[model samples]
Target chain A: MRPSATAYIYIAPAFALLLFVLFSPVIYGFWFTLFRIEYGAPTDFIGLGNYVRLIEDPTLLPTLSRSGVFTAACVVFTIIIAMALAVWINRLPARTAFIVQMVVIVPWIISAVVATLLFRWVFVNDIGVASYIIQLMGFDAVQPLNNPTGAMVLLVAVSVWKRIGYAVLVLLAGLKSIPDDYDEAARIDGANNWQIFRMITLPLLKTPLLLIAIVLTLSTFNTVETPLVMTGGGPGDATRILAMDVYERAFTNYDLGSATALAIIMFAGNILLVMSYVRLARWQA
Target chain B: MSTITLSSAARARATGRHFVPRLSWLWSGLFGCLVILNIAPLIWGILTSFKGQADLFRFPPAFVSFTPTLENYERVFLSGFGGNLGISLVNALAAVVLALVLGLPAAYAFDRFNFPLRRLLFLAVVASIPLSIGAAALLIPNYVYFASLGLTNTPIVLPMLYAAHQLPMAIWVIKGTIEGIPRELDEAATADGCTTFQILRYVILPLVRPALGAAAILVFVGSWNEFVASSVMVDSPSLRTVQPAIYSFIGFFGREWGPLTASATLAILPILIIFALFGRLMVSGLTKGSVKG
Candidate 1:
């Protein structure tokens, strides 16, 4: 179906604006990655040297692994916990469920930076409640932001806490769409609650679960602020994810060529992930 | 008869049902624990914001402030930091408005008419999300581009960047809302001799006002919280957004917890107020629109 010329004309302004603001910089970044450039110097063509260097960089593999761990941990924890919460809430009275949902959703509204700051204070060694509690429990004091494993745990925990709201909300929506009759029928057939959920509810939730999985994966893969504020990827670079490495290379180290190359690589990986997700979605459909 | 016998047998087997109730209580207790844990951080931040500098770092971390002073708030406003707050407000509001201006009409067109390259255009819009963040990769090229155009570090740059980032989601949301309206209304308006513009104004806009409000609030909150792009593009202190301004609290020597928490509290209040008032509508709009889209 073709639109009238008038409609095309109406959309032209937005199209033009997007082309310049969104597409232009991306195209330029791709082009810039092919050259060796400095802050105030003429670009010299470097062919694939920058790309090769990016592959050979010592920190590259470790950073990528850390990012993988972070993304995987966040995705797994958020889905399981959020789904459980959603299911638990769904089993409650309507008023109680509504209040619980509201409590869960409020954290998502707070700004990422604000959330980071709050958590930063919360994980402070001497002052944080968690630290004090742990000390009280006869464990050695843990400086969450200073230890690599601890920092990763803190980062994943924060991501889960900040993001589980959306996951729970989406899962709740999915749960609501499942008719009550099916559960009742299963119960009448002597299926236990766990069996009923596993056989009926989980299988029926395929689409929404797929959506939650993919979105959570992509978003966590690109997360930057939590690590930046919490640990600065500290304690011998244990917490440094690919995004932070990219930021540090480009801004802190001013290695523009290498940074752009890494960015392109990250972009390629994201596209691959999204394509797989789309294929899976098609297969499911 | 067999089913009834099985049901009675199961009920008899389930006579030791104390475990189920105990498990229910356990789940409820766990949920309550999570809620308290989640809100604890924010509560602590708010408390710290009201404390004096000496009290902020007090060992044992005082739960209550002995004497709360308005000094931090005063400093946030009077000590040149207020300029950054002003910039944040201007940039976020302007970007949201600009996005609406460009997005609403395009969304309307997509919803009302089937056009050539409609799917292609929508895909292009959705593809923009990946390009929005990780500014470090794009900073050099953007710097060069804006330098040539003489727009670097200017206030106009932020809204433009934000509008670009937000346009795709805004358009998708508004389009979903518009499409949910019945097409019969459009036909009725056309039969009444209304042109496309008139039909949109009289028939479609009012119907989708709730969605529009949702989009506006979402955009406002998103842009208000945006950090990376604004930090990279805007260097002038006066033009910095609130996020970067708050970063000032973390100097080489420790941190100024008092001012940081206070300023953060200030920055979050507006969004909190908006969410408190329009939380349900925003949630419904976002969830409904995403699932539908």
Candidate 2:
């Protein structure tokens, strides 16, 4: 058989499974949001009613803005810290760099639910390490988990904590792709450290930085696990991000129409990120 | 291959290395804080896991001073986390095996062939990589579709979905690695009258083994750690996976740290070990796949 014909045969099984699991659902979901689906069946044709309700709903806008806050916070911290760690690793002797990476990695490598549990233990009320240490330092023991703003900040911190390792890895990969020649050439021309970085390194690092930002934004914006596990969207909806809102609308409220509508919106945002990711990715590839 | 770091640290000088500026103590202190920030939760959890119930409420949380015991582990095991752990293992193992079986030939084809619609098909695969990981968007669509098909609440469904989810990544990793192998080897084998299957089995498979290993580890981690769909789709107690089970345990052991910490510790131990052993490979693989963490 010709190679082209055989290629079809080679890809058939995977394509079959992926179509059902990945592709079909997209079609199904888009169709699903157009109706009032009840007990696994569409009972009413409600074209755009679900989406209109979603837009007009009081709770959803706040939920979405909360997600905006969450995603922005996580993206900023993750990129900055990861960039620092990556640059630091680049300068270090090989062994020390590896050790630093290894230390930062453990929290991120574990399950989100597990990581949430672990981080919560650190700041949990009376027995929490943070509280005890604060008491020892002659300060008031602040209960971050119990207050609204505190919970949101704590949630963001936990997210950045777990997310930094992966960002550091990707940014480290980005940093390594830059050569020493740029810095040396700039130095030879009397450029100092800041000038070499601001001009030479930062611009070269732009694509990778953009790629990581998109990836991090996608993960953090639609993340349901950490908030669900830690705060459960509590402290009076303080941490009720868009993803959790979708979950609650569907499972908790049994309102499939609203839930799927929000999901489609989120999915649309995700596709934009994926498109940018694909563009930047192939340039590197 | 799989175990290689994304890039060697010993490689050419990095212009960004002087990022921290002159004060060694400043960066040193920052690095110290980073280590503590990252490592303390894990250490505290492990310590909490070993502490007696009384120690949990103590005014000062004891680090190493608390008398350690395995009662929490015993409690968690006896309360049927063993079963949840087993289901997770089975699902993760199945997902890895199935991803390889379905991904390899296609990855091989993707790299070696000039075929119609190849780019489109490959694009479809790559798009699904991140789509599968970001659970909030995928959960409702997946659940609704599976419910329509009567596929929800089944043991096989999770693994099937997990495999499909991991397939694109597997193909990306394996295909990228295969592309790195010298194409001349395949031509050389073909010149010797070897069939395509023989060349694949004898030449390509062995050469791409590390990628296969890396793909397997990624798939296992993805499958094992999946919670959003697992929690929503499968409601039967016997079929519950570890992450969801741990999530539920919050309700079961509210405000009780011992058993909760113990379960969290137990659940993550295997992944931690795999990561420690294959840290380099996974770093390389995940960034190579460039889709997931």
Candidate 3:
């Protein structure tokens, strides 16, 4: 067989799966949104009714806004914390750096289910560790997951906590890839520590920073388990981000039409984020 | 004394290197505290797993000095979470094998051969990195489609869905590794009258073994941790993964703190051990994809 024929042969299985599984389902999902699905079947051709319903749906705009806030908070906090941790890890003695990383990365590797379970226990009212600590400090023992705004805050915190390790490791890898000579030369030129960090370090970090930002943004945006398990989208849907809302629409409401519509919107948001990242990444490169 | 100190500085020619040692300790300490904060929840959870129900309800929550018990573990195992854990393992393992089988060749073809729309196909797969099979949107369609096919609640669909989700990462990581190998090796093999299959099997596959292993571990972990799809697609109690099983313990059951913590611990122990053993490979695998891409 021709090499190209052979190559096509090699690619066939994966392409077939991706086509049938990923691409087709997404497209079929979009198709499903154009119709009214009832009892797991399309009953009527709605022809954009679902999309229009999405716009007018009272719950959706708030949910999107809530998800936006959560994603923004998570992306910002995770990047900042991870950046600081990476800088600190970069400065540590090599051996201690390894050990610190091993400890820190425990959260990232552990499943979100377990992480949420742990967080739920830690922040549970009255009998929980964090709540008890707060009570000891003479503050009201607030169950973070039980209040509206507090639920969003807790969700973002847990999301950040779960993912910060991966971001830190990636950022550290970026930092390490930058030669020490850049800082050395800057120092020899009479630059102070903060100045060197500002002028030399920050610019060089744009790629990894963008990489992590994009990655974190997507991960945070798509997060279902944190809100689902931790808050159960509780406190009146205050923490029900888009992913959770999608799940609720599908399974809870059995409204596959709305579910598909919301899913498409979410995927579009993801695509927009990814497209911008690609543009920025290209410009940086 | 001021003159001596100034002259000593001039003689020593300190270029901020001396200042580094003192501040290094401070940074290390700060990082130590941060690391503690990072893993604190897991530590607390593990402790709670060993605590009796009453001990878990302590006012300030005892960090130590309480008599630990295995009753929680006993309850968890007796409740048949072991079965749920088994499903999680099987699902994850099946997903890993399927991803490798389908993805490895795709990665190789993309790396080695010029084909029509290869870049487009490759870019499509790259984009798939952020796309999850467990997304509620896709899952809705999948639920309808699979239920129509009578595949819902079956054992294979979760792994199949998981493999689809993992295929993108598998392709990207393996492709990155394959690109690193010298093309000259393939050319030399061809010159020696080796077929393409032989060259791939004997030479390229072995060379990319580490990357493949890393990808497999990542895929497995991702599959193992999956919740949304598993919850939606599978209805039978026997089909429940550990995550959904753990989730089931909340709310209506009034939170059996001991059994809950114990079961959560049991569910995560394998992943924790894997992370401990292969953490470096996992980190390198992730970095390898990000940096190269």
Tell me the deviation in Å of residue B284 in model 1.
Answer: 1.4
Q: Measure candidate 2: CA RMSD.
A: 7.2
lDDT of 1 by residue, A47-129 (tens): 88888999998889988999999999999999999988999989989998887887787677777777888878776646766
Could you tell me which 10 consecutive residues in candidate 3 chain A have the lowest summed lDDT? A276-285
Instruction: Itemize residue pairs with steric clashes in candidate 3.
Output: none
DockQ of each: 0.46, 0.58, 0.52
Tens-digit lDDT string for candidate 3 (B149-257): 7888999989998898888878888988887898889988988999888988988999999999999988988888888788888989899998888888765335767
Over 4 Å off, model 2: A1-3, A283-285, B1-22, B291-293
Ranking of candidates on DockQ, top first: 2, 3, 1
Model 2 lDDT tens row, A46-142: 8988899889998877887889999999999988888777777788888988888888877877999999999998875567898888899999877
Q: What is the interface RMSD of candidate 2, in Å?
A: 2.7
* TM-score, cand. 3: 0.93
State chain A's TM-score for model 2.
0.94
Per model, kept true contacts as a fraction are 0.34, 0.64, 0.56
Docking class of 1: acceptable
